[model samples]
Target: MYLIAIAWMYVVVMMTIAEAASPGGTLLGAFFTLVLYGLLPLSILLYILGTPARKRRIKARQAQEAPAEGHPPSGTSSGVAPDARSQPPAAAQTDSVSPVREES
Candidate 1:
């Protein structure tokens, strides 16, 4: 699916070239609009196909692959409690951060 989108980028570029080289200027204008309209959606689709989505996809896939409760295939974070375990999630702790203590 992702490969299809990636290839579509090249296809769009080639289409642009073809549209430019086309004999009928009206055909070129119509194809140019098509390529313009497709560019944003294609870039977004490609990005989703690429790295950011890949991580979540792999994690979700692994979790689905294993059929056990409380076993989420050991993500970047540990399965244990922050206090019990060595490292804690960033959002979990608040002591290190200070209050604003604003004045009028």
Candidate 2:
């Protein structure tokens, strides 16, 4: 995946450089060439090639989750009860810290 992305970038950079070096080629023209000829096709190719991998990952995740779906989640690994996890501590419940300081 990374290799494809890197290779695409290299090709695009080289193409941009070539376009910039061509007779009567402006930097703006090079930019447009890079976008049109390099990035557009590369992006489309990556998306098409990546579809199956993405689908497989999603399917694997769903399969792993299916078994655990029927069971209720247990308490935290640290042994904190469900009740403690549901509520904030007493200090956090009140706005004890004032933003403005009174002049002495």
| Leading candidate by lDDT | 2
* Model 1 Cα shift for residue 102 (angstroms): 42
Candidate lDDT values, in order:
0.68, 0.76
lDDT of 2 by residue, 1-104 (tens): 76977888898899889889999888998999888877888889889998999999997887778557753334333233335557644544666776997799
Q: What does candidate 1's lDDT look like per residue over 1-104, in tens digits?
A: 86787687777766776776678646657576556756778877677768777898997887887655555446444554555465677766567666797898
Alpha carbon lDDT of residue 83, candidate 2?
56
Candidate 2 segments exceeding 4 Å error: 1-9, 71-104
lDDT of 2: 0.76
* Pairs clashing within candidate 1: none
Query: How many pairs in model 1 have backbone atoms within 3 A of each other, for residues 3 or more apart or on separate chains, i.e. clashes?
Result: 0
Give each model a TM-score.
0.35, 0.56
Clashes of each: 0, 0
